[model samples]
Target: MIWVAIAISVCLGAAGQIFMKIAMRDAGPFPGLIGVVDIARYFWGAILSWPMLAAIVSYGISYVVWLGVLSRADLTLARPMVSLGYIMVILYGFYAGERMGWERVLGIVLIMIGLFLVVRSGARV
Candidate 1:
């Protein structure tokens, strides 16, 4: 159960990152140090936008769940489970319009296999 929660937290965290990337796509990079009010005013629209808001919410939930997972599971067990998010994030990136070449796809597949091997190793330990 603790491992499950940790995995879920990782998924939420990955999703949050993806949402933030989508939100920033049109908004451009972080602005150079300008007037305080100017920077604040410019980001006010983005901070309140749906994608940004979703990222915030996802992060909040992930933090809470991670705390719960840590209380029940050893860090070693919980942390490795989070590697699943690499696979999740790669898929999300592809779905969100990032063009994935064959090399990237093969790399992601290798990562998934590595994650599975790690899980099998944990069973032995």
Candidate 2:
């Protein structure tokens, strides 16, 4: 129940990040402090992208589920659980052909260790 909701929230958050990345694949470099038209064009393109739409929906659902999770679990415990999204997003990004440097790998490892410690401490409560 509560665990399921937490899992769903993490997954949805990761999915949203992946979808956004995919949607931005073709969107060339940012126009750097450009005109309003450029900004509008960028946002319009994003709004029309199916992947972006999916990302928005995924994030919306994740937020709702996260609220439910918080209602049942302590914030100190549940917040660290959201770090699971970092691991999932990194894996998905690597699989999707994004750069995977050793630094990123090390960061992921650190996040995993932190998450483990948090969960373990929470369980003792």
Candidate 2 lDDT by residue in tens digits, 1-125: 87789899999999999998888875666677789999989978976899999999999999999989888888888888889999999899888888999999999999999988888884631
Q: Which window of 10 residues has the lowest lDDT sum in candidate 1?
A: 116-125
Candidate number with greatest TM-score = 2
Summarize candidate 1's per-residue lDDT along 4-44 as a digit string, tens digits.
Answer: 78778998999898888877875677787878987886688
Worst 10 residues of 2 by lDDT: 116-125
> Any residue pairs clashing in model 1, and if so which?
none
